[model samples]
Target: MQNQSLTIKKEKILTGDRATGQLHLGHFVGSLQQRTALQHQYEQTILVADLQGLTDNGHNPHKVSSNILNVVADYLAVGIDPQKTTICLQSAIPALSELTMYYSNLVSVARLQRNPTVKNEIAGKSFGSSIPTGFLTYPISQAADITAFKATLIPVGDDQLPMIEQTNEIVRKLNYIAQDDILVECRPLLSKVSRLPSSDGKSKMSKSMGNCILLDSSERDISKAVKSMYTDPSHLRVEDPGKVEGNVVFTYLDAFHPDAAYVHELKARYQQGGLGDGTTKKILEECLQEILKPIRERRKTFISDKSQLIEILRSGSQKSQEESNQVLNSVKNAFGLNFFQL
Candidate 1:
């Protein structure tokens, strides 16, 4: 009998953000933490998706252009080691756009319209009756991002499950048409933590709405945001029994507080009509201040050297460009489009 042993390939993680604004706690809770933890465990890439940022903000290109470095700074502040993870500017990688164009043909307009995530965003953006074609087909572009690097894992939120499904759809179709497994299907690494709602608790945290506490927010800013956090309106008086559900303060406490038992105890006391909102908010403010102070300091240092950030982006983009070019070549050959040896 022959001894048999098998080696498993490490899973590659591809995650990123649209460079619309500075990253915030919503990003911290959703993906940044996971990316940092996974960096040492697997090969990871973070794309500052400037092109995707342009999909909706085509009218004000400056907003997208200006925030690219801010986004990179946030990544550095949050413990994303550039040595372990490749952080690249999306537009610099020409292969991604080319792949997007090729992948677009495999998907349909009707299919893009049906994506629940895109539809919800379109409504939120008030793009009614005039959705930009780029905005509508961004999921295809995301497919290109994943497959271009041959990523096996994509960290996403629950709302983004449809995007992963759509990518795999493209992967299956292209593989079938090419009669080869040229592209790999990727899976979503959903965050275990729940979504972090805005401090106002009226909607999701958004930079445009100023409802988010940015990663680079000052101590005063974090404290102010925490103080204004939505708590139980019914509990007007300290003696009045407070409702924990829909109470943004306790929701954050549950998410970020160091001790679970302590948070649970506080919640019980508040529900039983003793703890005051002021006291609770004060506690949360302290917690947030402690968490954000280090991040702010680190971000400040990263921003001090503009050349360093540019170099980081240039080097990462160069590495990604080479990898993506190889994948794009394979894709073109699949379509019989590599007509010339050159």
Candidate 2:
């Protein structure tokens, strides 16, 4: 119903979650925060990628389905305006899947296997010789997702740079073969903060690992998680000098705390041997609570009105469908796949 224009002068961004679970603090620090700031500056389209989630979650349809609204609520809670950012469900846009099928031919199996992001993920899942076909091909689907919206910017973690490179490769291949600029290329908008380590000091914060602080976590939950967060393992005494690097609590503070000067002072005190782990943890907890309280309250409001949340997603998907149809039609015409075209 909105002005879902197929042509716009402003640059566009397309990004979203996999609808695998509730978003966490890591997501906020890494991408969501950046997205909120960029929405007004760019024509943004945020997607709840249910079909891509199925690459790994195919057997768990209910998990993906249920988490779609949960992800939408998290987006709204973090200030992703439905009026400014088109938040849509991936499965609802049929054009993306069709684009993926065509784009798949533009890339080769060896190239897909060589993608660093894919290799690391497959290694983590330990799929061994039986990696699902969909899991292997999800990057092509991602390429389709970006090109379908003509998105020129993608907010991604450092590890995902290869995915964008792969997308552009397909774009070049398509245009060269068609002898027309039928597909647009996209670049990665890298996150400013490096990956946030898990509270338990793992290199990554993951839902499957059960080490994340959910965006909607209660104050009590936040406190409990922060108290148990990993610190200098060898700092056996309160007066002992502690290492600040790789200290998960300090890392979180650096990522989320608003007062840079204060955090810097805390880090210096922490390394100078007077700051106790409990004291630093308390500061980190307070800072996190201050940031998350508003988000939690906002999430509660959206979650209570499921129909409204669904309607927002439905409307966004309709607008996205209209826009994607334009790109899909162009692709079909370029490839001579549009049998109806004279």
Candidate 3:
């Protein structure tokens, strides 16, 4: 078992995924991969963001609950050792809710509205007029989640940098006004590779879009998903000049394939009118299958016994509560809001 107290030189880290659905390749290369690496170096807190899940899936709490296990399975399957990381379900932690209420007052509606990430998300989801209050205030909730753990480093993709900035701004504002350094400032650990797009190459891979290749998917399913991936539309004939630019096949190769020189050679040949899109897609499919094999096998082993999986989460939630309580007490003292007069 890995040690619980990793040498986190700065402060702890709070990072998690909303339990919307099973995590896919996009999540793997973008965030989860980096998170697993960080666990060895930091006091990592992984939150199953059920409360944030409700922002959009409020009517489907059961779906969210079911997927919570799926998300955990994905995490475990990807090498996130439970013994080294504290994993907590967000709704299970009451201190997060308490912190969110306090932080919300520190931020204004206008500020959230101006957040580029929020704006893009709202537009993407077509929440033009009926955006829920919870969804709108999620940034503040995120601040609570981060501060509750006193996380100094949040690993996220480049697109999520705005949220980190928003959290930091709130941290600075609260500490400045209270004349105390209560909330720790957080920095974004951006991934070198951006998120993978959907199989059709139209947008980012998402559960709702039905374009994800899940970590738990069978080898056949992964092959099928990759086989159907979109490529250059103009490349009709095998010998026709193919464009590697914007081709999903080349994109995946660029992101995942270990042989950078080979991929660059393929791209050069692809642009020169000799390489076939089908051949390129085949290579990508094979490469993806190789990468996903171990993850799929691990997931199968995990699903073979539900009891152990449940125990992992229960234990994780308990451990997380212990740490979060300490932070909450410090926060209460900083604001002179301790209820018991201790």
Q: How far does residue 341 in candidate 3 sit from its true spot (Å)?
A: 1.1
Highest lDDT model number? 1
As a whole number from 0 to 100, the lDDT of residue 18 in candidate 3 is: 93
Estimate the overall C-alpha local distance difference test score of candidate 1.
0.93
lDDT per residue, candidate 2, 98-171, as tens digits?
A: 99999998889999999999999999989999898999999999999999999999999999999999999999
Score every model by TM-score: 0.97, 0.96, 0.94
Ranking by lDDT: 1, 2, 3
TM-score, model 1 to reference: 0.97
Q: Model 3, range 1-342, lDDT digits (tens) per residue?
A: 766555435458889999989998888898888888988778898999989998998877887888888888888899999899887789888888888887888899999999999999999889779999999999999988988888988888888889999999988988886788877899988887767888889898888677888887787897788788888889898778888878888889988899999999999888888898778878888888898999989988876777877788888888878777887777677677897877
The 10 consecutive residues of candidate 2 with the worst lDDT sum are 1-10
- How does candidate 3 score on lDDT? 0.86
lDDT of each: 0.93, 0.92, 0.86
Higher-scoring candidate on lDDT, 2 or 3: 2
Q: Cα deviation of 336 in candidate 1 (Å)?
A: 0.7
